[model samples]
Target: MDARASAIAVRDESCVGDEFAPDIPGLKARRFWIRNSGCVIAAALLVTLSSTALLEPLSDVAPPTGPEQKKPVVLARTRRQSVTSPKKARLWMPRTGRPETLDLVERMGDGSMSQTSYFDISLDLNENASGSAASSASAVAQVADTGANPFDLVLQDALDARQLMRHSGLGYAADAPKAVRPADQSNVTVTPAQEAMLVRRIVSLPVQPERLRDIKGVIGVSEQDFAQLASGLGGDVVRKGEQLDLIIGQRPAQPNLSEILFARHLAADGRERLLARCDDGHFQLVTDHRPYDRMVAEALAHQAAEARSGSAQAVPKDVAALQDAAADYPKLIEHLARRNVPVKVSLQIVQLLRANGIHWSKTADVPQLDFVFRTAEQGEQELVSVTLKGKGRDRRFYRYVSDSGKPEFFDDAGRSVSKTLMHKPVSAGQLGDGFGWRVHPILRTRKFHNGVDYRAPMGSPIVAAGDGVVVKIDSETGYGKYIRIQHDGGYTTTYAHIEGTPKGLRVGDHVAQGQVIAYVGSTGLSTGPHLYYELRVGDTYKDPTKAEMPAGTTLRGRALEEFRQQIGRVETIASTIRATATSAAHSAVSALTPGSDKQ
Candidate 1:
């Protein structure tokens, strides 16, 4: 035995001897001796085991004194076996939250309510998830059991779904049972040409959600997988024939097709993704849909490239094509019409399209063809309209059309036409801070703060104070994200703590007056969400609140007169909106009145 165990045994022996000789309680002393003897034996065995691997030998020679150590075993949940029956299985897709739990009672052979049970495969979104990775791993592990499927399926991100498939080693089923077709079947039709068109249209769309210009190849995901996805997507997506349509219900008349294409791209794996360039010179994601079109376009481009390298002559153009030689008359007459297009714009449009073979066609009682000539002015713009009359080879037509001293476009789509030169500043409320103020929040002391702060939310629109060139856009550093625009007369304006800058505006990019360049944010050294606006003249910071800055835009002459004429229409619409709102309020009150509807 080790020294410590020997010492403990000797001490216990001495204590037992003393208790027997001097203590009156002999029975209690005998009990203590028995307990000490057991402890000594246990300690000796533990020490022997610690010094050498003799526990196995000891167990063989003697016996175990206590229960043995063990690993807790977990058993998989067993599913009760049922006799096979001719019953159709229908999948129920749950909403964003869990559906009411329905207990299974019995099953009837028919699809009626005579006897049935529904196991609601409801989802609990706010359920205490075991975290993303752990839940994914556990879900994948469940597939290994051969007795029965633990889960029907898990709806997750495309990456997670793919990972689950890989770990689970489940083969994708291309063909699956589909919902029964409508009895009428009047609206459904399958056409080879239409299929080709649909594929072409999908592939031609851009890969990026914002700019659907990338033309990647197409991929054919399994039909079963796609059906499941369609079910999960709810009614937001419409599946007609082989095409999936994602419609933004807000704009029902002109539903955006590109957004739907982007949604599909996001759901697909990177391995099957198609790559293409958008019109804005950015890379976009796409899918492999039309192999033939892509192959043809690639081949043609390659051949053209090879020909160029081999010093080939000019590329071919259609020899049978004809040009319109009598196209300049209407354009020239349209140029002379100052009443319709602004005189300056009319002249410029005529000058640009002077010798070009522009065609004119007549429709109903009004002229339809118009040409807009870009001008050198910062914000001023113009267009020329020409009446036309032509049908075939011998037909000819010519006339001039103009607006006749009326304002052509509303300055703001959200606001009514302005009656005065001074339209209300883009947003309402009041200025909270003067420019070049020195203040501290925590210490309550003075420190030179560069900009004036405007109280607003994180996503409030920040409009351009004037037409200007964006000289700086900082996406990093102490300012967080900011935009500095250099306006006319060497004046510069800066807006800081922006949620996001305008889509394409960068350094040297021009911005029109009143255009939204950024949204307010609390990104930088800010106490709360607000816009830190600064106006600078040359290198000197000016007090924006006190400074009488020149107005950036003005309505003049006929434009002003037209604006004045629009006041009555604007007021009438405003009044109508107010009346409608009041009527709605009154109806709501009446409906809520005690025993009104119930009575």
Candidate 2:
């Protein structure tokens, strides 16, 4: 049969399907004409037989299903070939303008077409090929004839390209690469208004305990938990690396005396007030309300009137009457003389007072008067010093006033009896709070205490720790009325929570060791009347009880000779006084015993 007749027969067969034929009558007429003509019938039979023989190699492959069958078919020549097995195969399409570039297309099982460069696929296949030249050629011919699916081969090439791009640090994508945001970038959105509101919220938070106590009460937390909360508030949180840290901040400074008074509405106006006065230069006093100046003048005049009467009766009728009337007998007498009391009468009264157990005497003609007194503890058993006026004095001890005018006691050898720094500034005070870290009672937070506390009675005398000049006399919220004294060898001592200093005590004034500087009081953040004493070397604080201090000065030269000379007389008097007191005590004990009278 001719090729034209074979082509015609193939076209007729393709167009003659029962479900796809456009005209049934035309199809029937064509079938009748073909059947009647023997040549046409023979040609049709030959075409069918030849087509079946040509497509016999691809009979094992399933027909293209779904969308793949809809693709346009292109005719290609194939050679008869035999292969034991073909692993994968693909359809190759040549590029329009570039003969070197070929597109290898494969239909996936899911009816998707994947296309890749033919050269790339060929190179990969060459690298992976393990068969001989003849076997490879035979495999290619069989693939072209049978149209075998290349899904696996195309997927493997795609995977290789992706891995290569990744290794080269060029990430692969189906479309264009997009700009990726950094993972560390903050996602939080905060505006200026929001930031300002947050700052205001933090600034307006109440810090005082009175204002915050209600929060704990409402939250129903225990005292310990509340204290923990307060400590947390006082601290700050910081981030370091991948972890967080809590940092505690320094405590705020306490308010001063004036600030405290002003907060409590007790501060007086500093502006001067107008005063009303009579033309005669006397302040006009009113019954409803008296001005401050007028009230002060009246008090002075009343005190003058009383002083006049008291001066007239300077010498009391008896010692008992004088003792009952005068708080300080010697001072009262001196005051009378200063108020123009008769000199003769003042001397007579002084001699009479001296005879009546006063023991007051003058040092030759000097104005300095000395007094002798016995302590209730030792009574007359201890020989009271004629020079020392107060308690805590021993007859065996010799007092030496330094060139600096600071008095210190010494033994016969002239070694100082006092320490360089006193461990306790208040003699009668008991140890209370100690130095170091502790949970604050009022603040409910952990804090470091820079000083030690001494508990003593209110108004009890507070003395200097050593011979030093007063540096600061000021009031603070925490320290109240406090005094700082600068001593030798970089040593400084602070006396705090004091009621007041002596009338003449001021900053820059020299205070001697054991000199009464101030009185104990609960003038600061104190639980009771006590003295807060601090010891410092330069700017660093130290525990007063444990700190090693400099050695006390030793008397030498003329001072040493004078101290030794006085020690001998003081020792003799002390021995005589002790012996007499022992004898008297023995007599009293014997009189009290039941069989003593008979003995």
Candidate 3:
């Protein structure tokens, strides 16, 4: 400090060198230095504090730098408040379960119009347990708050909520599902019964069999769940009141009393549900569970098993699988025709047809099973019919037998053999005694009897042997009651032991081969109710089996022409198998029932 002060005094001319001195002295210099030191220290502190305060605020307000930033998370849309409708909407049921969406532009309470999306839902009222809704493009579709009560509950009507839910123990008010959501929306609940009904409805195909061939898959159930619905399969099923009830499973609170009306559609669910009764229901919607058609086939298979038990006569010894359209249909049908189905299941079979001179008979494999019905309407005609199990579209139908006589094989010199023989004279037949020298049961003597005795039940029908005119109608003690008919060529035939004369016939009446002649009975010298049939040529008796009569049935003139046309129609139907769709499965058996209207 002393050197710096001496140098500063020498340089400054105002100082006047070191020999001169100031009048104020050292006190003024000390006072100036104290003030300068205070100003410098205060300035430094002010600069540090100001910088720190500015920096603290900048650090908080500034955008984050580097890798710390992240994208924001989106949240679920809040459900809207419920709205009450002013009046009831139209109530109607939808025929099909096709999905639909509605965009509604509604006016709010404050007069502002708002657009909303409404999804259709279906719920089972009998169920009280929780389930899910059918899905859509987003979760919002599932969670949208319903705008109205959804049901036009006219509680003032005789139908209370409990009555509306059917007789289910679940009262409509407390247990039945409503469109209104709870404050905390939990999963919808369903009962086992509701679920079973749902599955049954989905599996039920339309009345047409062709439509059933390709069934749509079930939506809400699993394979195992759908299978368990066949409760009657494992247990006995009985018709209780109006319903087919199962021995297993809990009985409904009240027996379900309903009928199938063609006018209104009813299903395993309620009798008939209208959209006006309730808007939409929520199910824990399941989708694409399993093969629907296969399950139906399985159900049908099970039904067949039940049928087999009751109808020992109708079911074939060899339970033939349904052969695709082929000779097999005729063969299977022939087999089925021989037996009778139980009345309950008879309608399930689609058809019954008769294969007459076409050679179902005289063939070893194909049984001669002719189920005929007598009609009093048309002079007592007989109709023998069989069924066709029209399989797939394939043309290779199966054969009942291998050695049947075809026209090509029977042709001689490009012309077929002589016309075929007439049908058996008696309704029930098989040669009990041949036309040879044998011990006659009544006479007990060996002699030639030129006729065959057809074994038959009492009061059995006897048809004319061929197209012929009545030659004689005689009642003798030896022949009991007999009718002789003169046929084409010099051939003639006689029916003996007839209980009564054929109805609506006289001496001059020309008769067809299948015309009813008489009823079988033990009228005279006979062992039991049997038809003693004898064939003759030019007044000389011959073996009935060896005798040949007219063919193509015993029709004549206009009647013969009509028969030919009917056969042609039958042949056309036989050829075009699967392509034909008929609603006559029920119609086929309806005629057999007592109260059924004639088909």
Candidate 4:
């Protein structure tokens, strides 16, 4: 369109509202009249705009609408079961930190439990409904002597539980239902609102045995010695005074007393005896005497006289006969070897057999004997060449077959398979501290330590015991910068005093076995930058060395058999710690616990 026509269209739209525009072409002529139409349109538009502006002030004075509505209301219910027989029941909920009040219900034998119809007991912190300070004091007084709570529930944490019971007085031990056992009489004497929970009576041996029978020649012997001997014999030592009680049931009876006295058979003489009787009722074998040999000898001599008419063919001195005789022999030949035997005669006997035809057989992987002696003196020099086959199970028994289908024997102490057993990854480090009661360097008195302390340099990689979840990671009062991993089988372990913890590591993170989680550090209450390690069963701290560590699950079936057999050979390696007794074993085992170099 021409400029004149465009100008006219714009003027017409701007002036009146463009309602008068024609849709047809040739608007060019209209442009020429656009300038003329502009003045006319401006005057008309001014009148219209002036009228709207004048009327706008009147529109602002109108009235308002109703007030804002509130949100819709909906009634909902939250349901919770209450504890039935609240007044009569004495319940205990065990946990750490805050104690939660739970509604307890009693379950019947059929798996149905009694429920509270509708009753909620509200606890008021203020006023008389609140537990009294005097009641708290009384609960403390009651539990102080027992070392446990009277509510039949011990706080998962004993000390913390006692403090809560003392301060809150939330439980009524006096109201506990009558004890179901003989000790229930004590419950009736409990005072009201008092911590009347039943405390497990400490089991102890009576002050003395009522009957003091006339006895003589029985002297107290070391229980450890007895235990060691019993273990070597694959039997347990139950100690009586100077004598250990032997429990010999009839597995298979020996030929006679002569068979046992001569160490020809290991079959029992058919008797079982309880060893020692202690004040704590804890009995162990008394390994102070060799009563078995003498008893068997006497019994054998009597039986021999009666059977003198029978064919007393010369017994082929074989390993089986020796094993039978030594089964009831009180002299612990095996224990003596491990703990330094003083018997020179036994050593000479062993040397003679080992140097002679008694060579180790490759077939059974055990030593064999091929000589028989008519006299104990000839045992040192006699050499009757005859092939014999057998497997050495102990120092007394070598079950083997002779060339003539007859079992032959020797009087040599058989070596044990377990004697050569050694634990894997032998660690070569000093044991700094052990788990259990020790004087706290900071506390200045005895305290229960839940873990072990390993002395190592900083930045040492701390390995995970097994695959587990990192449940906790924090620096606490005594434990500085600790990491806890929850493993399977209710096992949990902690590694503390870590330096340079890996990034992105946090709680709920899964870790694999042998994964490096952190480095050693002196972060918390440590004496130096060493690793402090702990093993917990559920929440109870246990001696890491004593606690059964989870071995690789892959080592099962044939793998486990091989592993066990391998360890059998491994245990024979002498521990780095000086072998003394109990303390030495603890020290040796501690080297394998966490945070220490176990290799």
Please report the candidate that would top TM-score against the real structure: 3
Q: Write the per-residue lDDT of candidate 1 for residues 230-332, one digit (tens) a residue.
A: 3434322321111221211111233232222222322323223333433542324455333222222222222222222432121112100100111333323
Question: Could you tell me how far off, in angstroms, the CA of residue 574 lies in candidate 4 after the best superposition?
Answer: 41
Q: TM-score, each model? A: 0.23, 0.26, 0.27, 0.23
lDDT per model vs. reference: 0.38, 0.44, 0.38, 0.38
Q: Indicate the residue-level lDDT of 407 in model 1.
A: 25
Q: Is candidate 1 or 3 superior in TM-score?
A: 3
Candidate 3 residues 1-599, lDDT tens each? Answer: 49898557534523243245455556346545655676999999999988877787766344446778756545566543323335443322221111111222222335443332221212221123111121111111111122111112121133332342232222223344545467545444434333211111111212112111121121222233223322212321111111110111111242232111111112334343111101121112122212221222222222223223432221231122212111323433322222221211221121222112232222242322212121121222222123211222211111111111211111111111123345477757766888877888888988788888888998888888665688888899878988888875567788898888766778877776577888888887888888898888886888877664443223346644543543443333232111111111122112223333321
Q: Quick one: best lDDT, which candidate?
A: 2
How many angstroms is residue 511 displaced in model 3 relative to the true structure, after the best TM-score fit? 7.5
- Model 4 root mean square deviation, Cα atoms: 41.0
Q: Report the lDDT of model 4 for residue 120.
A: 10
lDDT of model 2 at position 404: 51
Worst 10 residues of 4 by lDDT: 210-219
Give the true-structure RMSD of model 2.
47.0
lDDT by residue for model 4 (1-599), tens? 88898677666654553346565555545544665777899999999989878887887342234585545545455332322332422222222111111111222225432321110111111212213333333333332333321112112233233333222222224334444566555324454433332111000111122111111001112344334334433444222211221211111122211110111112224243323333443444444222332222222222222222321222234222322322322122232121111123223334334333243323234333221111111122121122233453533322222222322222222211111101111122234678888998766889988887877777777777655678998888888788988864457888887775788988898665566788878887778777777887875887776554542212234534544443332121111001111221232222223332222
Q: Candidate 3: list runs displaced more than 4 Å.
A: 1-482, 486-492, 496-505, 508-532, 536-542, 545-599
Task: Evaluate residue 450 in candidate 1 and report its C-alpha lDDT on the 0 to 100 scale.
Answer: 66
Backbone atom clashes (below 3 Å) for every candidate: 14, 0, 25, 38
